[model samples]
Target: MELNRTTCYIASLRSSSVSRGYRRIIKGFTAYADVCFREFGNHVKFWTTINEANVFTIGGYNDGTSPPGRCSNCSSGNSSTETYIVGHNLLLAHASVSRLYQQKYKDKQGGSVGFSLYAFEFIPQTSSSKDDEIAIQRAKDFFYSWILGPLTFGDYPDEMKRAVGSRLPIFSKEESEQVKGSSDFIGIMHYFPALVENIKLKPSLSRNTDFYSDMGVSLTYLGNFSGFGYDVFPWAMESVLEYIKQTYGNPPVYILENGTPMKPDLELQQKDTRRIEYLQAYIGAVLKAVRNGSDTRGYFV
Candidate 1:
């Protein structure tokens, strides 16, 4: 189906008045999810409420790289604040829908609901400095814990709370109760690992920071080449799984997207040797994590 300009504009959810619009967006999303559950609950046993929720907020609100494309310098948007606000609303919407299904349809449908997050295995650039090591943990908190913390522990990580301060939205007692432990499983989309370097933010910039700025670290992507390329690093997948297992109580996980991208060459596509090797190695990494009791349930390419 094609979306007209008006529909696309409204669906963008990009408004001059963000706070009020955020509430309406959440309400609309939850109502839509309720309809889908009532219509498809019997046929679909596993429902992923939102795919890459973290990336959607970050890319759309902070970086201006996705739909509705708003950023600090864009025609509209507060990169630092809007990203957090959008993320907060997305979580509330997901939890509300999950609760609706659990209360009304779960017993009869016997279905499970979860949400996906974009994950990266972060490694310190230099092992010599304690600062880099600390930065690594902080990056993880900003990237993974921003969402997982609420799902697993009922709130955002303390580091994030302290970093974002008032810009970050607060959850009430009842909202917290509903958000905590809302998902039956957590879906992860991991492509590569990043070498994290410690970076000190200027005091002025610190006063007005975006998500990456608040992270207080620089990420260098490494693989077959610099920048973006066909880089296959299976060990990164193993590290990510292990981190989730050791830190997040090893919840049920599905490798929702773990594949190597290739150019659209008919001959190369027909052969597809690199793709096969990538899958084999990554699947092996998943097996290692599962054998080590990581509670990983499935892998999808």
Candidate 2:
């Protein structure tokens, strides 16, 4: 059987979903990607990072969804907090290999490599006043900061500094540069909108509540989680595309995933109308972004 490299998508070894208590699992698969450049120093053309690191918070951390199905490291409990650390460790592990490939094959022709990050959209509620700002920042602080800050700036988002305190790990200056330095493109896996507003911590889950669920703030409020709240706003997709373009210096972007889940209503088909519209709006944003000189190369919906 002839293998079609073009259609080949390799599982990432750096992520625990594939790494599974391993030492350098990806090393074995590089050959299959035909990543070898030269019998005599010739370089391979291109590469991409593991499937999508951004979904870890949602799947691995929050909902106990997908493989290795405990609520993830990014959650609030002692166990979940440890899981968040584990998640970061996994990210660093992946980053190490990403850097290794670039270093080992500097002379490669037309070489470009990157990874996908899932970005969840957020909208602040109107009635909450200034508390909404804190809520929005927390969400940004929780999700976007981890991937974006380090990938583009060589540091985790500063807001996380307060959250994790001394538990937060530090990178040496060299390592910091390495973390920020490795991207040739930004991979985006965006889906759905969220409404953020301050909510007082409930007594039963107060400490852990803020920890895992990341409550809006001290003020009283309510709003969206993945499926429950995405229906309210649709324009924010454009904001997300534009935000990426501006923040990441307009580096090329490949949207590796951007789909929504369907409601389980009887009338609905697996065709998932909400998911389809979600995709359409986001794709429209991508087009508008490209036309506006945003260097958005392509997207996979």
Candidate 3:
């Protein structure tokens, strides 16, 4: 698919309603996928239904940090529900495209359709405290399980359903069946890890409270969040892979994005010593993870 075009269409769909505009998104993507399959399926064995699906939803709808930005306090969009609504629609769209490929192209092309998301390693802010550890789990549920749980188990995580309450969309019987096992694999973009601190929900928080508020945890980004010349914790890569393997039934995995950015410098660009070391450590971690029986199939910088 032409990523730039599809992305613009998708990034704008959150403001749409399921009755009309949302279905258009589903049809639009299916139409695009059909074309891509016909044109590129023979050579492209692996197809990602969406790039960084989780981040796409969060950055656009909840945080208003990216294209078609929308948030609780933004000029439009309800951060509390739009994110989930858009995420739900994305899953449906993916499932539709996956079904289309499986029925029409998979046999001849021998290709696969997969979903991708952005992931970051999370550790307890207070290493010795169980609450912080539990907070980490909650954070994963809100982030990873929110998308993966449906793709794997045909439903959102129990924690998300409970936390988001009626704001979360429900999957119909057919939709649930379509969503479960639709992906042949999982793709992830992993960069840095974060220290997660447990937080209490404020009494004044409303139904329109944002996802971060609903998540009930705060992240202290390591390396000050820019990820340039910071500490390299390769073990976190292994940790992330292990968690996905264990939590999500060890599906075939690919590291679609992994690398640190560096400031502009001619010598630095030529040598790239820091990036070389960063990738070496992370790729080594992936190697160790594969050695330890992770179903990880590929890694990319």
Candidate 4:
């Protein structure tokens, strides 16, 4: 609690929390940011406010797989509401922290604060099916636009609002203004791609549908994704960069994390030609995107 925020300071602090056993994000994150900047901003050049924000929220709040693990099927959770609420708080916290750095620390520290999300190159299940083609956009709305829409345009994707309905949180005018241009860069974490299939889920009488259900798309990954290494599809990286370029006005981007996982065998680890090829292919993809006019500033492996 102490590490998270200044919960102790606000004696009257009360959260209108919709998620079970979780208070709405209040002061802990920005307070922690302030401390980190005061102590380390002089040396740090890039500060990413959150890492893999979307995936983290969905895993923890909707899938019951991470910290504060809670979901509809768990002992206590409302996957329908908590995922959206938690994701909203993450955006709010990033905005607050970014604003703080810009106002109080930027002039003196010469540092940048950025926002991050895990990105997948979403493809249609069938190349010829119009429904599958459209489903790719729907998947992007939930996976990409859920974070970038507000950062770039000050609102959630219209599709998301229509689908999630009242469960999706709304940013007030002030929040919209604050979150719109809060980041110095858009950080992307990429490794693989997903094939998106449109699903017509029958209307549930109960209000317990999770984020995936709300998005109305199913994502299936290709390859042996159980840490044996990732399948290389460099074109997907180029496609992602292209989408961001056309959709979000070519914001400055950084590939914060991108790497293939390998099995834990010492012999294979030592003879790691696969990882080399992965890096080479992805780097080539980034170079291709750059040639095609993506404002991608950096990449990390």
Candidate 4 per-residue lDDT over residues 1-301, each given as its tens digit:
1221111111112223425334335367688789988987776778888888888778877987876667889877778988898788778888988899899999998878888888899988988989988989999999899999999999999999999999999899999999998878888888888999988876765345899989888899866766667788888888998998999889989987888777787876778787778888999999999999999999987
Choose the strongest candidate by TM-score: 3
- Backbone clashes in candidate 2 total 7
Off by over 4 Å in 3: 1-21, 205-208, 225-230
> How much lDDT does each candidate structure score?
0.81, 0.57, 0.84, 0.81
Q: Candidate 3, residues 119-202: lDDT per residue as tens digits?
A: 889999998988999999999999899999999999998888888899889999999999999989898888789999998866
Off by over 4 Å in 2: 1-46, 72-78, 200-205, 209-234, 260-281
- Candidate 4's displacement at residue 132, Å, is 1.0
Clashing pairs in 4: 4-28, 5-28
Instruction: Highest lDDT: give the candidate number.
Output: 3
Looking at model 2, report the run of 10 residues with the lowest lDDT sum: 1-10
Q: Which 10 residues in a row give candidate 4 its minimum summed lDDT?
A: 1-10
Error of 3 at 262 (Å): 1.2
Shift in Å, residue 18, candidate 2:
9.7
Model 3 residue 286 lDDT score? 96
Q: Estimate each model's TM-score.
A: 0.90, 0.70, 0.91, 0.89
- Lowest-scoring 10 consecutive residues by lDDT in candidate 3? 1-10
Candidate 1 segments exceeding 4 Å error: 1-21, 204-208, 224-229
Per-residue CA lDDT of model 1 for 1-301, tens digit only, reads 2211000012244444233235776677778778877776667777787778788778888888887688887887888788888888888888988898899999998878888898999888998889999999999999899999999989999999998899899999999999999989888999889999999977875645788888889899776653334587888899999999998878999888887656677886679776778789999999998998898998887
Candidate 2 per-residue lDDT, tens place, 1-301, comes to: 3211121233322334332223243444444334433332243334555556656544644454544444433332233353455445545654665666666665554466676666666667764577776777777766676677777888887777666666556767876877775677777766666667767665685555323354344322222444643442335556677777787677777776665544577655745666666667777777877787778777775
**What value does the lDDT take at residue 140 in candidate 4?**
93
Q: Provide C-alpha RMSD values for all models, in order.
A: 4.6, 6.2, 3.2, 5.2
